[model samples]
Target: MSLALEFVSTVRADRSGPVDTLADVDGLTSWARAHAAGPGFTASEEARQETVRLRQAVRALFARAVAPEPPSRADLPDLPPFKEALALVNATALAAPTAPQLSWDDKPVLVIAPAAETDEPTRLRARLATAAVEFLAGPEVALLRTCPAPRCVLYFVKEHPRQEWCSTACGNRARAARHYREHKK
Candidate 1:
């Protein structure tokens, strides 16, 4: 999965309701470190706000990419216009000066390197936005599906021809609900 998919999954569906894992600075900091966007990145309140906005933008784009299929209910409230979301994500990805640069160990490796002057938060945002842009442009976006299982608000790439729900747990839940409905009547 792309970091973008994982990032978008942060706004999750709970039994009670939608939950935002990045609702606070500490959460954002932990997420950043976990994603290796920056190992020691400490998110400021400003960075938290910016990151959330970027997430919204990415979610909006993902919603558009999976057109005609409803998007994650969790993201519905914050989604901006498709054009606006596209602009925001592209802008964020362009904020840092990054280029394909060569790095060599035993074998030569090509890497996209952002400028040394860019701060951690900015670089983190750029990396995430770039990944989202790439995901949206790539063929995998066509396989994106919003989980149809009741109370599920996640998206997943359809890995198999028979795949429907986001996970086996969701599939089981959906089947159980269907069985209950059928027998109750």
Candidate 2:
């Protein structure tokens, strides 16, 4: 999975409640360490708050994409934060030095390696923004769907043709709900 997809999954929903992995400074730090490979990513209260805001904006954009009615240009979700994040990512990419190096093996293999930079958080954010834009603009946008299970608020990229819910647990919940509805009738 791409880092951007993993970032989106950080905000998960369960029966207890929605778990925002980026809720606090510590959480943000932990997430950055795990996903962004940035053990030294700065974690401040302001950063946590900014992450939350960006998460919400990203979620809103997904919601609009998967909505039943195609949103008009005026009705499209505003993505100022995503734009900012993308800019940061673009700047980082532009600054990165990519050079091909030959491996010291009997069979030589060439690889393009990017220079190491310390801007971890910005890189992660840029990855996420780029991914979101790609997902929205790509043909797979049709496969993007919100979970239909009761109380399930997660979004998933549908893999199977018959897959409806986000997971088997959600599928069971939806089936149980349908059975209960039938019994009630």
Clashes of each: 0, 0
lDDT of 2: 0.65
Worst 10 residues of 2 by lDDT: 69-78
Error of 1 at 107 (Å): 3.3
What tens digits encode model 1's per-residue C-alpha lDDT throughout 14-116? 7888888899999999998998475778999999999999999999988887879888888687698988999999999888868889899999999978765
lDDT of 2 at 113: 55
- Those runs of model 1 whose alpha carbons end farther than 4 Å from true positions after fitting are none
- Give lDDT: candidate 2, residue 110: 90
Best by lDDT: 1
Tell me the tens digit of each residue's lDDT in model 2 across 1-185: 55555666677766786677887888998888877645667777876665665565566666667778332222124334545645543453454344678887789999855445535554555455556666767877788877778776667778899998779999999999999999995
Per-model CA lDDT versus the true structure: 0.89, 0.65
Pairs in steric clash, model 2: none
Residue-level error in angstroms, candidate 2, position 145: 0.5
Instruction: Write down the RMSD of all candidates, one decimal each.
Output: 1.4, 5.0
